[model samples]
Target: MSFDDDPGRGGGDPADDRFSTLGGTRQTRTRLPESTGDPYGSTRRPQRGSRSLVMVVGVVVLLVAAIAFANRGSDSGSSPDGQSPKKPDAQSTAASGTKPVGGKQGGIASGYAHDEQGAQSAASNYAVVLGSEGMFKSSTRADIVRATHDPAVVDGLLSRLDQAYTPSFFKNVGLNDDGSTPSGLTFVSRTVPVGTKVAQQDGASATVEAWCTGLVGLAGPGSTKPVTQTWFTITEKLKWVGGDWKITSSSQTQGPTPVSGDDRASTADEIAKAVQGYGGFTYAR
Candidate 1:
């Protein structure tokens, strides 16, 4: 569910595997390393600006866009491999032409329509907010919980996550004990949704899975947990409560991950600069 700064966890947060293929033999033909692992056995050392993160995010983005573009006047898009219809009618790849939300509640998107499209939108945006660096802080995390979760569950959820995002957790991710970024460094924890799928849905309840790639850790010179990317999927069970879709329960797993790429890694300065320069989008279907 959660990953730690320690690379030993084998979670593959980032750059965890460069310099692995220094020397190796090929049989009859040259074969690329397995998309999953480094040359150094099973563990991968995090590489700054790891190509895996960039490539995964890029591929997912392109795949989503291409599918949407291909499905443009149709009722719905096919699954990634074109094996099956992603959903029934009313399911779509384009916007619903209705406003995504009526307004913001505690700075989080709110008032999504009581429909499958609305559920997807709600899940996408919630994934971004929940995975943001802000969630590491107590005050901001509380606000996020109140804004996105069902009222009945807010208190309980906060109590649980408070224990989870403890000082030790913050420290592991390169944050100060108070969850603040150290001076001269930037903390990055952002989730960009690659796509959303409605796994199950009904009139008042739904389960949406957000396939996402995220950036975490610190970005600066000589940083220990240098900014790295991670691939993970967030599954949220939501209810159309009080005129809006709100999270009732949510959990994360490692990934519906793609194979690693062979692109050269960027420098820490480049990664930090890119994070600052590029503004994240308000994701939707």
Candidate 2:
């Protein structure tokens, strides 16, 4: 997950270092300790039993109704322009309220505005393209580099990437000398952004971190590098150029990963089929 090496081809640091610490979800149920006997059992004191019961029931009903009404109000709070209200997590982890740029360059999403939010959106989607299987191919790699990096740095970055994805490297990842998979195998390399955060912001410059989960390796019978998932985060330093956010420099590091799940791992054929059937998404914010 660094510029110097290619984890997409299984040639880099050990995955133990690339895992994130933020993907686990667990639920717990709690119950109050049960009482062995009623408080008034030994005292035998007369209580306002009927009246207290009625009062408690009425209070509980009022409380429940109040909570329901409050939640409804929270959910229905919309913009004056008839747009949906942004979620509470939007500012912290969810997609921004701003819409994604409605354009593409060399098949990669582009036209990000000159702002911190836009920079974050651009970095996220760009990360997706850069970490994909397309990077292994010469034509698509050139297009991705051109689309994501600033014009002045495009040539240099592309040259460095070209060396990184050498034929030997491709062979190590179960691809041929030209980065093509064998007839029966499917090469998979896809990066999925989980969240984005702006680390710094200025009028014309910004640094954003895109937390991502990726799938890499080959899938099929007798495949040496069976597809596996990894978690990592990419930081992109961007500048406002050509009326959009473009990468000046970028680096990736091990993740803020979570614990592995309990689901059974699918076979290679199952993985290949699933990958082919499911299309990827366009990330923003």
Which prediction has the highest lDDT against the true structure?
A: 2
RMSD of each: 17.7, 16.5
Residue pairs with clashing backbones, model 1: 15-45, 15-46, 15-47, 16-44, 16-45, 16-46, 17-44, 17-45
TM-score of each: 0.67, 0.70
Q: For each candidate, what is the lDDT?
A: 0.81, 0.81
Compose the digit string of candidate 1's lDDT tens values, residues 1-285.
323432333555224544222112111222344445446665434333335656888999999999987777574545667776645566445566766777888777888878888898899999999999779888799999888998999999999998898789888998888889998888888999988999999999999999999989788897999877789999999998989999999999998789989988788788889889998776656
Off by over 4 Å in 2: 1-90
Model 1 stretches astray by more than 4 angstroms: 1-98
Show the lowest summed lDDT stretch of 10 residues, model 2: 20-29
Model 1 lDDT on a 0 to 1 scale: 0.81
Question: Residue 211: error of model 1 in Å?
Answer: 0.8
